[model samples]
Target: MKDGKAGAVTELKPSRPLDHADALRAHGSSLLLIEGNGKLDKVTVKGDQAEIDTIKDGLAEPVSVTAVGGTGWIAEGKLSYIIGDNKGKDPGPFTLTPVALPK
Candidate 1:
């Protein structure tokens, strides 16, 4: 697989590491990973639990991504993101509303 070093991962800047959420976004064949759901737990990853907020207003499309409830958290795991020259139906420019998950 190609790493985010070759500009493949355009937008990836999470507070912590890239978890399942980000991994899913990377499916778009890009290195960027945007969180969709504001909640982190919503996106279930393999071998690790998600931890992030939710996408309140809407969401920004990463190359490909796996968001939780709504908030975008990087729980940890392997996922795929897709990024290419789409005609115009690109996702993103979304909300950054942080949320809290129930214990």
Candidate 2:
């Protein structure tokens, strides 16, 4: 991790098979969000083991994700948002929040 100090890169293995993860974002510490298989999953790492939890599900092929101030907006078949209580911690039950995608 290149937070500040230069050190050897440590590989974090996901608890479950990724299958086809297309997008990823890092949250505080070892928490991450992966977009794949029409869903968004939040992953956390402890030591060398990682765990995945579903944050959002049932979308049309989500491919990318971007976050700001601990809030993430996903681009599935459409660019919309799923609001959750995650702010660098706590994998949440995220819900969809509608937004107008640019035409």
Candidate 3:
């Protein structure tokens, strides 16, 4: 985006189609998504292609997600919750890390 204005919408082809994306949020140049199968995925788009990778799983149908600093907080359909970090060299995996919220 030049000058903070959105450019043309580009349709990217996912490595594997996200058939059950419940929640999606943009993180930098990538897109973070929660699928209906209780999987948290990080999607990176480049040109007309997008790659998908599982971050954290075994959730209870996550419905929402938000990223604070380098941590991501997910709402798992009111049953349980999970958290993770930006997984160093590899993007996914999202190992759990301690987080401090604002008052």
Candidate 4:
């Protein structure tokens, strides 16, 4: 995650396509919900000392503001962000394996 101007970049590869709802439940953290039709296919970090990596179909791009607060998940083809109104809503069973970063 990026903090202010300086940010630390980390590569994360999910074992499988994670369901949006399941991700939120697993992370147990609140997220912001936005609305938009922009498709995010790749992310490249550029700079003199930048550590760049490619993210494919990991997040839905051009997120528009649709709600205030909610949960987020990284799926196979797209990222999912649901509003808080969906609280207590079960999205069924999902599997998520921990991804180890390169040392």
Tens digits of per-residue lDDT, candidate 2, 22-66, equal 766776654445455666677777876778777766665466766
Q: Which lDDT tens digits does candidate 4 get at residues 1-103? A: 3555766655544323322222111111222222233221121233322222222223333332222123123332123324444445664544331222211
Best by lDDT: 3
Name the regions of candidate 1 deviating beyond 4 angstroms. Answer: 1-39, 42-59, 62-82, 85-94
Rank all candidate structures by their lDDT, best first, as comma-separated numbers: 3, 2, 1, 4
Q: Report how far off residue 93 is in candidate 2 (Å).
A: 27
> Judged by lDDT relative to the true structure, which candidate is superior, 1 or 2?
2
Question: Residues 1-103, candidate 1, lDDT per residue (tens digit)?
Answer: 3575553433433334543343444321222234433223223233333333333323333223343653334332111223334434544334333443332
- Each model's lDDT comes to 0.35, 0.59, 0.69, 0.28
Maximum-TM-score candidate: 3
TM-score of structure candidate 4: 0.22
Clashes in predicted model 2: 0
Error of 2 at 7 (Å): 3.2
**Could you tell me which 10 consecutive residues in candidate 4 have the lowest summed lDDT?**
21-30
Worst 10 residues of 1 by lDDT: 74-83
- If candidate 4 were superposed on the true structure by all CA atoms, what would the RMSD be? 13.2
Q: What C-alpha root-mean-square deviation, in Å, does candidate 3 show against the real structure?
A: 11.6
Instruction: Give lDDT tens digits, candidate 3, residues 8-97.
Output: 998888899775787788887788888877777888888998899888777655677788887778764532233333223343333342
Between candidates 3 and 4, the TM-score winner: 3
